[model samples]
Target chain A: MSRHRLTVVISQAAGKHPVKRALEEALVAALIMESGLDVSVIPSLYDLSPDHTGRLFLESVHGDMVVLSWLFPRAAFWLLDRDGIKGHLGETLLKPAADDDDDDGEPEAPRGIGAVDVPERHIYCIDLRDAATHDPFIDEVRRIAAECRTRREEKDRAASKPMMVELGTSLTANGTNGTNGVIGEHAATMPTFTAEQLLQAPGRRWYPVIDYSRCTNCMECIDFCLFGVYGVDGLERIAVENQDNCKRGCPACSRVCPEQAIMFPDYKTPAIAGAPVGAIGSLKIDLTRLFGGEAKDAVAQAVAERDRELVADGRDAVGMSVGIAKRQADKPQGPKDDLDNLMDALDSMDL
Target chain B: MGSVSEPLTFMMGKYPAVLPAELRYARNHMWCRAADGRARFGFSSYAVRLMQDVYFLDWQVNVGDVLEVKQSIGHIETSKAQSDLFAPIAGKLAVINEELLKDPSAINVDNHGTGWLFDMEHAEGGDAGTMSVQEYYQFLEANWENTQRILKGQI
Candidate 1:
């Protein structure tokens, strides 16, 4: 029996995502028991930082076969493409195809590895779609193993010089360089405010958050957004491109998102407070909540300053408080995190 | 482990609980039990708990297909997450749990019994040492401790 060492790369964020952990545990166990191959599971958490993807690239180059699960597929491919492996591997894998002998009706070998025009000889994509009955995947892995063995044999026989396939200018023209890089006019245009700058503005509290757990990369959110709020990342995943342009309290694109991966944190809260918490003239009550003070004069002074700010500039806050009153009246809180809702829906079913 | 339905619980906390001692175990926390020369597989109670709120099961492998140990035969999905279900041993798939497919929460509620995922004939290659009941318990205990350490930021 030939021993095959494969790396399974899992993508996670910095914060602990239970889903990613579960998938990693289950996948590692399965590979060890069923595939009977030497396997190492590598986690490439996206937020790991200043060198998040660089680490993944270094680790990925050592694997004979790389299995990308969950969010890793896009990031892995992007990394390989960025490092110029996509072109070289594409040429190498495609070279064998030109002299192909198999005229039989076997499924054509998978193409488009590493985000470029590369054959997927060494890459395997596993996601929710492949969660059930992955016999086909196992078969593909065996095929990759055979392919690698043949490559090794040929390399040993010839001791040939490595070929560097230059990715032509056409690839850049085709916007295949990096998915995150903006194409055409938007490349030069900067957003109105950075997320950090926007964070300082208090009234502007609502924007879409991507639930990586459920996003399917369908790109409906990308297509539906009029403002440049969403952009396709290097991995072809929809990302919040410009947090500033996303109209505060407006969830129009979110409603169109097929996966319902978009969410706003304070969806239940009205974007702008409606004339205070309690009775109209209860100044002392409002003051305590605002200034965290018991002194009557201090509390009253804080309330006056706050009310002035709300009356003068809060209504016009450009970041996220812009059209919230109208949005609140027109549309209900648009699609909160639907995971729990989906569970609820399922739990209520008779089955 | 009593019957398919009655699994044994060894709660370290709210999670990482339950195991069926009679069944052989996979590191993935799936279990395989041999009965009448056929191997029955299902998520161990601990695994089901980890999955949390499983709402759907997609059985991909059909009956009569030759199975390799650890090959994914199906997936169970919670609202927010989906995980592939792997076969525990090599065999020919003989039966699938159709009832459980319609009601996937059963895998959470009664993972050992009616929620049994699939059955295979002629399972192969698993040894008593790595896959037996006691070994699985040990694995669970270690995993629980590791999880505790992680929670405490010891890692």
Candidate 2:
């Protein structure tokens, strides 16, 4: 019999980058074959709608889950929650240190979008980019499985806590009702994956996650994205209609977004990689301030990038002629250097 | 390749290992020292270095049970991560390391000596898949960069 019903989900990347693909396969192999886990190789978390097979499988799972995905941990959590796989984010030791402002520096778990009607389970969403190989994942999975086993055992013991009090004048005996000197009934096991099985995968992934919590319907993303990745729904609200159309390496529209709400999740840059905008030590802050125009420079750079890609696609570069609007200034820069002092002084208004 | 007999820790400088030639190694970074069909195994210095500070170690297999290669025998937990111990060689489990079990930090302190994990009677010949000390050192050298990236949590 299996020790505990722990599942490992490999939420794969959309584009078939050999390195990412190889890592995903390696993780599945190590976990399924070695770690005594039920492994599911699913398509991109961002791409799975509520009715998708991958989402259906996720919805069926009852036990603790460890999701290894390419997206940022918070982004993955929200996507899973939105798909009805509700769970509190399980802690993982396998992640980069939080920016110092976090105080406890605990990983910021994005709050649930709405009240969860169904019971929440435990889910550990680990970033695929956190480890170079599968060892850390295997280690963490084994650890969690062991803890789950311990908790189950403790619950079983606790279920037997109250013994029937023998009083002279008390209750009539029923053969089924705690007849064995104990009042508490043992907890019935919940249905979970009793045997290990690997779920089939589409083997492709990559798309932007719109943080609608941060998004205003400015339509700048739809205006700036030359690749047709963004579109409008029936409400005229922004939607990621043609997700597959998003360029693999492009985050141009994310920069063009006035709200800073578009998250690539897999991108190396922290803010665009789903960290909160204005997060301390974010590289995006420096990039915006690099040319001192704050708002104009970032927009110009994004438009220029869009133009380069346009030219690469053999179309005319529509630099600023399209998606032309004043962008919001980035939040204040980090601790000042001499260059920042000079720039801040020059930009200051004379009263 | 310098001297298959030389201990790897001599050249470790920073990459940390005390891989004596007589010892064989598992890809998981455990070291086995075998002589006259009586074999002893422990975590290599490299594995301990990766572990950093050890907090807990426990065995699943009782003394006198037989273990097959890749079968999980026990697990060790530390601040960094919890690692399950897999058998690198098929053998009959013999002497368990009682003292090291009490103080898991012995692994970080003297992994090759007093911190030896367990003993086993051999399974006829040898573990075919394990690397010689020299080969293991080279393996560590090759994977060092990848290991660094793993430590940094970078893609």
Candidate 3:
């Protein structure tokens, strides 16, 4: 059996609602335990200061998985961004408070509406309003746990480390223009991206690249990429560090580049290599059937026939494509539907 | 009483709290003002500046509910953590900025105006004990200095 260790950290300043807090903590524990993962809940009285919180985050990163709860101040996000901590986790889960509607004087129960995407990780900002209904959060957590367990066992049995892809660059700081001198100064100063923005894709722009010739050994980028992307090599050369974790559009390093050597490549080419492939391969299904000339006329004829049939039956073609696709696909199971379900399941998890 | 013109040594070196005159502030960084009987309130610009990248705002209270002073009214989640919003004074909630529930970044855009969290009707004479604009300014000045000291390891 693969041993999965999960750690949960709650904010010290989450008020004195011990009962609510305990219930939330217990629910999280139960969800993990149900997945057969060994879980530990560590309660600390440390204030959520950036420096202090960053230290706690670094400690928790070593676990097989981690969950953070409680009322985290917006300032903590700036610290995390500066440290590039978001790039390290598989999931950064958030449970929004249930009584949030009470604060707004709204009578309706709050809903889960926020999500944030980091490179390989997904951050779910769940509304604690739904905490009473553990089904939504726990169901999601179980699926992720199952997937994680499978991946971990496969890697462990093979005795192979996860391949790290070097993105080939580093983030260097341009001189402080007397403006916000940091990478995510907007987040720190304006709270621009938070749980609300989580539901929408938070903007990820500018991938960092490094020029070794102009690079001095000054360790500023190393301190900034908190994602552990920059590190010293055997010869002590400040080289391209942890490139695998770099987000597709993170230009944070370029903004900080003192030598202006970092460059961001446009990634709009929608290459199929990054897409998922089925067992039989060959683009899974014939695109010609959907978009080829002969198929187009056939499809049009079929649509007209289906529409007439629907009109005659006093029904619509809403279920026609689904029924036909199910028949043509043999198994009648659509990968798109499965993938959507999987993404939803992953989003709902409390991990 | 000290002698006339004699400077009394009464912690003169301590910083005084100072807040912007036009801005209303709460103990938790929310700002409010009374227009007629209803009060308009929102997160201060200073608070928005401190909390960058706001992702969610969980406002649970609604119109007609009576809120007590200093009670947790709502919370704003940023990329990193969630911060609670506290009521500045006891009053009946009148309206909330519903736009923020969907787009919390509006607070960062114009914290003092469009980002206003909610509105309330102050209890009659409730403004009596509240700090004047000048006094609140002093309070912020002193508080900011103390925070700086704590950051500097002076506390």
Candidate with top lDDT is 2
Model 2: residues >4 Å from true position, as ranges? A1-4, A12-37, A43-56, A62-64, A78-88, A97-119, A132-139, A142-206, A216-219, A226-228, A231-237, A266-271, A275-296, A309-317, A324-351, B1-155
- Candidate 3: TM-score of chain A is 0.30
When sorted by lDDT, best at the front, the candidate numbers are 2, 1, 3
User: What is the CA-based DockQ of model 1?
Assistant: 0.01
lDDT of 3 by residue, A110-131 (tens): 1211112334432222223334
lDDT, candidate 1, A12-106, per-residue tens: 32235566566556655565564323344433322222233334333333334444443323333433433333422311111111112333322
lDDT per residue (tens digit) for residues A1-351 in model 2: 124457778888877778899998888778866534667787778767555667766876656788988877767875675466777667776754423333332334433123244443478888887777878888888887787667656765777552323323323232231223332221112223222222344444567777655667788888778788888877776878887787776788888776667777766556677864444332212211111123234577688778878888899998878876654445555788543443444344110
Task: State residue B26's C-alpha deviation in candidate 3, in Å.
Answer: 2.4
> What is each candidate's DockQ, to 2 decimals?
0.01, 0.01, 0.01
Clash pairs of candidate 2?
Answer: A13-A205, A14-A204, A14-A205, A14-A206, A15-A205
Interface RMSD of each: 24.2, 21.8, 25.7
Query: What lDDT score belongs to each candidate, Candidate 1 first?
Result: 0.47, 0.66, 0.43
Across B15-104, the per-residue lDDT of candidate 2 in tens digits comes to 545677878987667788877777788888777766667877888899999988666677676655555577667778989999977788
Share of reference contacts found in each model: 0.00, 0.00, 0.00
